[model samples]
Each structure stands twice: as C-alpha cells, then as structure tokens.
Target: MQAISYWLKAYGESHQNPINQKIHKVAVPGIFLSVVGLIWSIPQLSLFGFSLNWVWVAAIPALVFYFWLSISVFILMLAYTLACIGFIWSMEILNWPVLPISMLLFGVLWIFQFVGHKIEGKKPSFFEDVQFLLIGPVWVFFKQ
Candidate 1:
C-alpha cells in the first residue's frame, strides 16, 4: 500500500471503537475550527487594501502536504480552508471575540477526545507521531 494509505490505516487502528469514532466526528471539526479561529485572531497584514491573516499563510504547508497525499484529500482541505476563512470573516463582521472562544472550544473538545480515548483504551495516534495530528482530520473526511 501507499504511504498515505499506510498512515491512514494505522491511524484508523486506534480509532476503531464506535464511541471514539463518534466523539471524533464532533471533536475533529471543533479542533479544526478552533485552530482556524485562534490563528485568525492574530494581527494581520494589509496589502493593496486587502487584509491577509496568518491562518491563510499558515495553511500553505498543510495544503502542500495534503496535495502530496492525494488530490481528493487536497481538494477537501482546500474547501475546509475556505470555509474557515469565511467563518473568520463572519466572526470579524459580527465583532465576536476570536481568541477566547477558540480556546474554550478547543479545550472542551479535547476533553471529549481524551474521554473517548479512555473508553477505547488507547492513547491518541498523535502521541506516537505528531503527523497523526494532521491525519486525524483527513481521516474524518475519509470516513464521510
């Protein structure tokens, strides 16, 4: 099997428990959104009257990694990134505080993740390899 398939399968091994999978269904998106929000909260740079935030700049490496993994997954990540940008723009327009909200959501969702891992009787895949952190979200997309 290919490297991406191998990594995905290994990641899936620890996530087989139904409850864990269910927990991830919610937690993955929460984590994704929180990361986006947190990053978006950072001060931005304006070029030619357009504001560009770190979130968009930071996504470059991940997008390249995803592209190397698979075109379909790359497309999914692109869509996810665009959606996150839209969310950040909306939050800005609504004058919602981004940092505090992102932190709260990330912390709560991480607690749920730990609880699910406890039920599964396995540590998170990311504990084995940091790259699993990226894999987790893509794995969720693969599940759908």
Candidate 2:
C-alpha cells in the first residue's frame, strides 16, 4: 500500500496538469453516483447465478491504465473498488437499472469535468492520455 501510494503521489506530481485537476473535480461525484447505480444494477447480475467480482473484472482496464501513469492511480483504483463493494453490500440494493444509472452518472461527471476544465482554463487530461478518463473516477473518489 505504501509503495502504491508513493507511486501514485509521484504520478500525480508528474501528471499534475490542469486538465487532470479539472477531471478530478467532476469525477468524484460521478463515481459516487455511479456506485449508487451499480448497487441498483447488481440484482440482475446476481440472477446469472454467479456473483461478479468487480475488482478483477470491471476495474482491470482502469487499474492497468492507471499503473502505466502512476502507482497512486492504481491505489486509488483499489480504494474505489473497495468502496463500491462496501456501498453495494451496505445498501443491499440491486437491479438492472445500474447500466443506465452508471451511464447517467458518467455523463453528469463529464459535464462537471468540462465545467471544471473551463474554469481551470485548460483542456482535459484525456486530450493527452485517454486512459485519464478511467483515472478521473478514482481521482474523484479518493478526494473525498
């Protein structure tokens, strides 16, 4: 964990562009909402008779992509995954609406991000690295 933190901090420093900051501002709430939506969507996933492990599955691409940029991002991704799991378990809510809910959260987060970037007077990190899109969620989640 310390190693991951060190790496993430280093990555944050190196990639501390205005764009990333703006993305973070919006991504935080977006991820929170997305988590809620995921909770809402999980019941349907369970109907398949095998529950899913989101960390190894859904979060892989995001984690791999973050590790490429910084260990901090990987750590953040880890935290985000754990948080999502906790949220779902605590709420005991699940259904098929999670897909659209996640999308809606993403869209809202994106809009907030754009607004943040506009305020920062910079472009989004995605302009430099598309993977930053994935990182934005973790960055936002950890900030809280």
Candidate 3:
C-alpha cells in the first residue's frame, strides 16, 4: 500500500479549486453523518440489552483501514466516528425519523458533491480509485 502522503497527493490533484475545497469541507462531514445515520437506522438487534445495528459492524473495518494508514488518521477518525455514532444515537432516542432524514441528507449532499466536482472541472478521485471515497473524509479532516 502507498503511504498516507501518496494518497493525500493523489486526492489533492483535482481539488485545487477553492470553491470545490470549501464545498467539500462542509459536504463531506454532512455526507458522513447521513451515511452513518442510514446504517444506524437498520433494524437493530438486542444483544445483551444493547441495540446493535449495522453501523457498528461497518465501522470496524473502516477504522481498521485508517489504523493501517496511520495512527493519527486512526485516532482522528475514531474520535469523529464515535461522535457521529453518538449523534445518530441521539437522533434515534429523540425519535426524529432518522431513516427519511438520512435519506434526504444523503441525496442532497451527494448532489452538492457532484456539483463541487463540476465546478472543479475534473472527475472525482473516487472515479479513478474507489478508495478515494474513504480518503475523502480523511483529506477534509486530516490535514486541514
């Protein structure tokens, strides 16, 4: 696997436009939150008196990838992921209609993501390498 810097540079190649950068800075976190919420809304199982869901299941491997990339990335993503999970939990507890809300946010934010790429005049990095999907949040939070 390439080093973290390699991935960073590759992801950075097409993100030079300031507007795209600003759009991504806001949209990516929102997207991440919606994604987690969508998964969290999955039918949960009562495991040892806990409401368990697919969100927890998915986060494990994603975090492992971050840990493999670099400890700083792992710690940052761990903290962010936990925070996102906590927010999802609160939404569930408040009965705020997590599923529909997540779906709305996901669709809207993805539109903005594509718009940002349009403004940048380049395809999104994920088109070249799917791993860029994961690298995106890291790029937004890791070095920024």
Candidate 4:
C-alpha cells in the first residue's frame, strides 16, 4: 500500500499537467457515474439470491486503491456510495435513457481534461501509464 501511494503521488506530480488536473476534477463524478451505470446495466448479475451486478464490485478495488494510494477512506467511500445510488436510481427508473446520459457526462468530462492538458502544453498522463486512468478520480478527491 505504501508503494502504491508513492507511485500515485509521483504519477500525479509528474503528470500534473493542466489538462489532467482539470480532467481529474470533472472525471471524478463522471467516472463514478460510469461505474455505477455499468454495474446496474446488467440487472441479473446478482449474488446471495439478490442481484449483485458485479459492476458495483468495482468499488472494492477503487476504494482500496484510493485510500491505499492518496485520498481518505471516508471521502472515497462516501463518493462511491453517492455515485452508486445515483446510478441505480437512474437505471431502475430512467431505464435506457440513463446509459446515454451517463455516456455523455463521461465524454464531456474527458474533453475537459484534454482541454486542460492542452492548455498546460503537456500530453495527458494516460499516454504514459494506463494506471493513471484509475488514479484520475482520486486526484479529483484531493482537489476538492
């Protein structure tokens, strides 16, 4: 965990271009929505006699990674839960329309990140390491 934290911090600093910083901010909630929507999309992927929707399980690695790397466990969990609830509500109630809405949100957030990077005159971090993708949301947590 310590090693992961070091890497995350290093990655953030090394790739702290303007675009990444901006993207990290917007992408946090957008990615959260994406994850929740993903889990809720497969309504039958349940466990223990109830629908589990393995997508929700994404929180495990994400939560572990964030707290283990940089952000606090409290904030990470709270954000994850809120995102999950929003996703579930949208999917269960709005149905098919929710997916497009989530996608649009995700897309717009990503564009902002790129624009930030462009302003910074540096390439986006994901170009160097894919793990940076996971690191993006936690970066946003710190910003807040």
- Pairs of residues clashing in candidate 4: 19-116, 19-117, 23-113, 45-53, 46-51, 46-52
Q: Which 10 consecutive residues of model 2 have the lowest summed lDDT?
A: 1-10
Output the worst ten-in-a-row residue range by lDDT, candidate 4: 1-10
lDDT of 3 by residue, 1-144 (tens): 788899999999989899999989988899999999999988887888987789989999999999999999999999999999999889989989999999999999999989999999999999999988889999999646
Estimate, for each residue in 8-82, the C-alpha lDDT of model 1 and write its tens digit: 899999998999999999999889889999988889989999988889788999888889888988899899888
Q: After aligning candidate 2 to the native by TM-score, how far in Å is the CA of 73 from where it should be? A: 4.6
- Give one digit per residue, the lDDT tens place, for model 4 in 2-91: 455555576566455655665566666676676566555555565677866566476667666666654564467657666666656766
Please tell me which predicted candidate would have the highest lDDT against the true structure.
3
> Arrange candidates by TM-score, highest first: which order?
3, 1, 4, 2
- The runs of at least 3 residues in candidate 4 whose Cα sits more than 4 Å from the true structure, single-residue gaps closed, are 1-8, 14-23, 46-49, 94-96
| Candidate with more favorable, higher lDDT: 2 or 4 | 4
Q: Comparing candidate 2 with candidate 4, which one achieves the higher TM-score?
A: 4
Please report the TM-score between candidate 1 and the true structure.
0.92
- Cα lDDT tens digits, model 2, 1-144, are 224354335335434557657567657656655755564455434435787644345556656766775676667666766677566545445434456757777678768766766766667666765554554565455543
Write down the lDDT of every candidate, Cα atoms only: 0.89, 0.58, 0.91, 0.64
Distance from true location, Cα of 108 in model 1, Å: 0.4
**RMSD of model 4 against the true structure:** 3.4
For each candidate, give its TM-score against the true structure: 0.92, 0.54, 0.94, 0.69
The per-residue C-alpha lDDT of model 3 at residue 71 equals 96
Off by over 4 Å in 3: 45-51
Error of 2 at 71 (Å): 5.5
Ranking by lDDT: 3, 1, 4, 2
lDDT of 2 at 118: 72
